[model samples]
Target: MKINNKDEYIIIVGCGRLGSHLASLLSKERKSVVVIDNNEKSFNRLSKNFSGFTIEADAIEEETLLKAKIDKADVIVTTTNDDNTNVMVAQIAKSIYKVPKVIARLFDPSRQEIYEELDIDTICPTILSAIEFKNIIIEAGGED
Candidate 1:
């Protein structure tokens, strides 16, 4: 659990579409990253695409976080499909270990406000999806 001062360490939980994309982009920026995903197969997509540490485990567990060196992390980003798990992991990382920054992915748009109120930055994929949907509808509608 060593954090190198030269680069900020970022922990990304979940290796699904969003997580994988974010991890790849961050790794491209040359940031030290440790990604945790329960499904071993989830990491397959990330293997060649990402140049960072990958851990196959639950991010909700403190021990898992410790193993990933959450205590030393500059930021913890929970991007799992499960909102509860992401929120819980964010809370633990923020409240317990007191990480300077915690970002939790919100699958449900309904919870975005609440997460923000709690001082956890939430990235709602639904919002982005809706915007994309709107653009597609507008483009197709114009052709008709």
Candidate 2:
């Protein structure tokens, strides 16, 4: 389902750089956002202007997912540093709760195929950085 309206709910797992950034952007747009992280200190990354539900708990746990109301979420984005943890949470969101959209951030590019097989959308910064670096080099004609 398309979240064109502000009332649509978006759940973000992990409050690190990527997760916090996404939550801040979505919150600024007035979208209903819920951010989960194991460490409460991690929530400090969020901007003071952000007005979204912050849950301090391990997202890999089913209980945390329940508290976050994963079932009613229109979209779930897992940005944990661990590829395995991201995969597990993504699968639960997609297969069990059947969230309409599930996105994950994976650091390892090799695991892209695994996430693809599970029909989970993934953003790999490593791969993106590599591609961007290559493009810059090509455009610079390999000049110093």
Candidate 3:
């Protein structure tokens, strides 16, 4: 099938909480989305209104990405639980598949540098939560 570039094509690897939420949100925005996960049960986390495709396959496998049409993806997000898995998938999407926008969920803030060096964008929840906590403390006039 020919993918239309007019619509944003997003490929999400790992249908965990974050991945599923993103898929559902993007689907609601009417973006073309395909979610991939090894465990078929994980796909159930997606919202009932999610209008997207789900693929049950290990994202580490090249065949799985090929099936997802990685070459045609405009954006790819890797939200796997394992940091290594997320990095690997992001690298493949950016370096190999040449997807324009590649983002990976990183649990460790220290690894952000490595991802930056690889030219892959990362969203670190741990770091973000810490920043939010700091902001709240400051707003409360807590001691430094």
Candidate 4:
């Protein structure tokens, strides 16, 4: 399929494990992808697999987002380790940039509802990881 401005450009914040995997997958699918992170060390995840642009900066910063052209981005995915930062990034994407979609990775389950109230999509990796671990344990007959 042909992608254009109406197709929604994807901007992924945080270049850690999940962020890297997500960026590579999205880019591979022929979607416009931009990855950002505060620390340069996190970008190693995109070193080889990512075919998109990567920026080293804070996603919550308006300057950084502007530099990444967040105003034109159709979607924003904030996968930072900090829940507050993720929420702020999503808010800016939605309220400021008016991006159509924003997804945030939340570290604390307690703030999941708060994020939703703010109109930001939030994913709790801790809960998902725990569920996956339980499933694996069950599959392995509860063995270590």
Q: What is the TM-score of each candidate against the true structure?
A: 0.84, 0.91, 0.92, 0.83
TM-score between candidate 1 and the true structure: 0.84
List all candidate RMSDs to the true structure. 4.4, 2.4, 4.3, 4.1
Q: List the residue pairs that clash in candidate 3.
A: none
Q: Rank the candidates by lDDT, best first.
A: 2, 3, 1, 4
CA lDDT scores, all candidates in order:
0.86, 0.91, 0.90, 0.83
Residue by residue across 1-144, what tens digits does model 3's lDDT show? 123456599999999989999899889889999999999999899999999899999999999999999999998889999999999999988988899888888998888998899888888998889999999989889654
Ranking, TM-score, top scorer first? 3, 2, 1, 4
> Where does candidate 1 clash, by residue pair?
none
Better of 1 and 4 by TM-score: 1
Candidate 4: TM-score? 0.83
In model 1, what lDDT does residue 33 have?
88
Candidate 1 lDDT, 46-124, residue by residue in tens: 7475789999988777789999998899988898889999999999998899998888888888878887998988888
Clashing pairs in 4: none
Greater-TM-score candidate between 2 and 4? 2
Tell me the lDDT of model 1 at 79.
87
Off by over 4 Å in 4: 1-7, 47-49, 133-144
Q: Which candidate has the highest lDDT of all?
A: 2
